[model samples]
Target chain A: MTTMMLVPGFDRVVELVPGERAVAIRNIPATLPVFATHFARFPVLPGVLLLESMADLAKAALGDGHWRLRTVRGVRFRHFVGPGDQVEIRVEVTGRTDQTAQVRATARVEERVVATARGLALVAAEQPWEGTQ
Target chain B: MRFHLIDRIESWTPREQITARKVTSVAEDCWRPTPAGPVLSFGLALEALCQSATWLMMLSTDYRLRAALLAVDEACAPRDVVPGDVLRTHAVVESMSDEAAVLAGLVTVGGETVLEASGILCSLMDAERLDDPADTALMGRQLLGKGAPR
Candidate 1:
């Protein structure tokens, strides 16, 4: 499977400015298995899943699926994302080097921001895992 | 497919700290296939750390409260966790109140640190609101090995 296909919560890339910025979306489905146990009575998308969405977008913005999340700084979740919500994710490259890229990311539902990561660093994997699976 | 990340609670000191373990397996849904091998996803590693911290907060509150992770001030992973690796997580309370708690956590494999996280903030709510108190108690018992093994 392609790296984008392996991204846990991402649906598709809506826009991409390679190595600069990117926007993606994920549609939360009620039938997702995680909801069954995250809270049987009340299901909300796990915060870590939201972070994964951001990391996926960060990798897209960096123009390399081989990039792996290395560090996270100042990530916060302000609102809950429930089933049927369409999360709009965006990532912008803040810094870059031959082996690493630093990014800032956000997730939103409509116009309200639900999550933000002030600093995320992605480092190239020693061996590109893509096309090998 | 179970959302409970940590497999077992090794030790806990009420309001002070907690230690837990998770044995990675190829069957996990979070496994990412790589040329090197299948490795646990970074997000799952963070979730395990958060769960460990949440367990400490819950035990400290006597199971009266449930914790929802609100912020991760800092986190870093130095190595990938692969199948058959036993992840040992240690979480310590930094500051706490009736509404929220801040903690620092680390994950190690065979005495070597694999991941480190600090300034984790979680919001506290009445446990009964999100989960049945009876079920929570039962799960706590099982995790701490005070109840029959599954």
Candidate 2:
């Protein structure tokens, strides 16, 4: 996708969880210009963006900022979220190694599961994205 | 690894969101050895359109919300889009309430719609309902400093 698609001015932050999980909340305001033109009638959040929320949760859980996804499994989407609905993201590591981890994740709205995915990723022993800066 | 580029948002009137053309080159990257041939993948095409909507909305409202595709949804590829065929992607914002928004998009070639799909994005997070604090600490530090954004 073009860099143009990346969210601008939007903010993301990680929060505390019950155990070893990490949570982050992002709010998509209704006034966003994309909606004004998405269509004359039918408008919905892009599927890729929903998938990215899963990735964002995984990124938050890994702690290390730089890692590429190797595989994704058991991904299923059930519900739809719109301007007012809050996307609740939950991600935890099912297993891990120095270089990789198996993560179990879920997206929800008000106790309802919107989507779920199992992710396999290659992680670095150290913070790789940090070195770049 | 292989990367596919999506379309751009040309303009957005009050009625509809305009998507620019998306192009995928057939060159083999270091990770992907085989050329992708003349047509681009349908999944990627739909992704490009959704990406376009996210950016357009953010730019128009001057707010940043992060999320990506949640599913394949109802995407259909009726025809092949070649390397040269400019896939013009389009989507409309159905409704926006609170912080979540929905955009439905279409990919077209020569005015004929080639693919269709939908996207749903949300804009709220509850700090109390997150995963483990220890696991989220490092990412939290990088994200919202000490106190998570309330």
Best by TM-score: 1
lDDT of 1 by residue, A1-133 (tens): 1224333457776777888888888999998889988887678889998998898778767876577787999999999999999999989999999888999999999979999999998888877343222
Which candidate leads the pack in DockQ?
1
- Interface RMSD of predicted model 1: 3.7
Write the residue-wise lDDT of candidate 2 on B1-150 in tens digits.
Answer: 222244344555532365666654445221111122234433356566765665455444433332244443344455555545666777787765435566677878778877776544434222223223333343323322245444
lDDT of 2 by residue, A26-96 (tens): 56666645444332233444444566566555655666434444345555666766667677777787776
Q: Candidate 2, residue B60: CA error in Å?
A: 33
Instruction: Kindly give the stretch of ten consecutive residues in candidate 1 chain A with the minimal lDDT sum.
Output: A1-10
* TM-scores vs. true structure, each candidate: 0.92, 0.43
TM-score of 2: 0.43
- Give me the displacement of residue A84 in model 1, in angstroms: 1.2
Top candidate on lDDT is 1
DockQ for each numbered candidate: 0.51, 0.05
